[model samples]
Target: MAHANTVLINALRRTANKLSSGTSYQWGHMGSCNCGNLAQELTLLSKAEIHEFAMAGRGDWREQVEEFCPASGLPMDLLIAEMLKNGLTTTDLQHLEKLSDRKILAGIPSEIRSKMKYNSREDVILYLSTWANLLEDELLEAAPSLESLLKWEEPIPIPEDILL
Candidate 1:
């Protein structure tokens, strides 16, 4: 699950980097950019500060993107949506739209799926629906801490009371 989270984080970072390039505003500012002030609001760091830390004269955008990912615990679809808001091309939008339906339903262990009552087709659909709505609400809130980001990766048994 940590691996999956890492993959999702990397995807979001890539999307953010792509969106950042097309915007006219500086990294930290609120408007005229896809992710609100996310680039700026994070770490309370100035543009120069973030540049010094992430860029470090390497000049690789991918590295910078990785640095940004841990700050946003969001899964990739919401990240992609935020990027699209900044002006993703149609092809990019199509790619991102596909992700929304895929991530929650992809490759879970049957044990875990069964726990969610997702043993059948209809259950999986409902799981996806709930996950989508939960993600929408989750993303609009503040960026999560790295620990919170990691916590979601843990596989634990749900109490019977909670399951019902």
Candidate 2:
């Protein structure tokens, strides 16, 4: 599972909500595709801007991620860097674009998983929600225990005169 940072979680949920709410989805459009939508949520760049940036490079999100160079200063690279800083890996981006991450797919019910396709908006929704759930599970596992919380909550002792 990808690291469960707050930014990443918010981006995933926002992307899923946008798509579910009838955001224009076109498989062939670079700006409105699966990864593009998520990129919009993360980078606050419009689809047109994302598409323009993508066109400045070759191939799709997968190729862009594969060829990412932080020093290149390309818009797509910069956008990708932002996503990485928020806890997504290039591998996760590739999988988001292609819907081909075996581990993530494996967690989906076989009936639904078998029907999923990369360019389908519903499939992307399923993928994002499932991935979010996995990340949430990881976050929950790493949460501080009640004992630890109580330890931190214990009031520091002070002389009664301090209250005067």
Candidate 3:
């Protein structure tokens, strides 16, 4: 499991919560789709705002990702930049939008590993939760050890009477 930043984990959780709680999900709509939800979480933009930005571009999420230019000041590009800042790469966003990232899928349980349709809300939730778990595992692995925690210089001495 690769280490993922807290920002990424929090965003994934927020997206999943929104999805599971009946936030509007329209796969055909740019703002309500998979990538859009993630954009919402990372960029703090509404679905309508994301849709408006996407409309300024030439294609859907996949195409937009393909043509992403960090230098371009388009809203969609700006949204992508926000996601990137939160630790997602362009490839990560692309895979997320396409529901085709092998690494994320590999972490999912085999029983539920069937092909995931890009527009399915349930699948999106599954994907987000799985990704969050992977990130959480990485965080656990990188956590400071007890020895490290106890290594402060000039540590306070315990009272001898307390030992009794």
Q: What is the lDDT of residue 129 in candidate 1?
A: 40
For candidate 1, write residues 1-164 as lDDT tens digits.
11113223433454344344442433232221222223333233344444444333232323233333433543332333344344333342232222223444454445755454312323433443444344444454546777787786668888999878
Please give the CA lDDT of all the candidate structures. 0.37, 0.87, 0.86
Better of 1 and 2 by TM-score: 2
The per-prediction tally of clashing pairs is 1, 0, 0
TM-score of 2: 0.88
TM-score of each: 0.23, 0.88, 0.86
Q: Model 3 reaches what TM-score against the true structure?
A: 0.86
Q: Which residue pairs of candidate 2 clash? A: none
Better candidate by lDDT, 1 or 3 = 3
| Residue ranges of candidate 2 with Cα displaced over 4 Å | 152-164
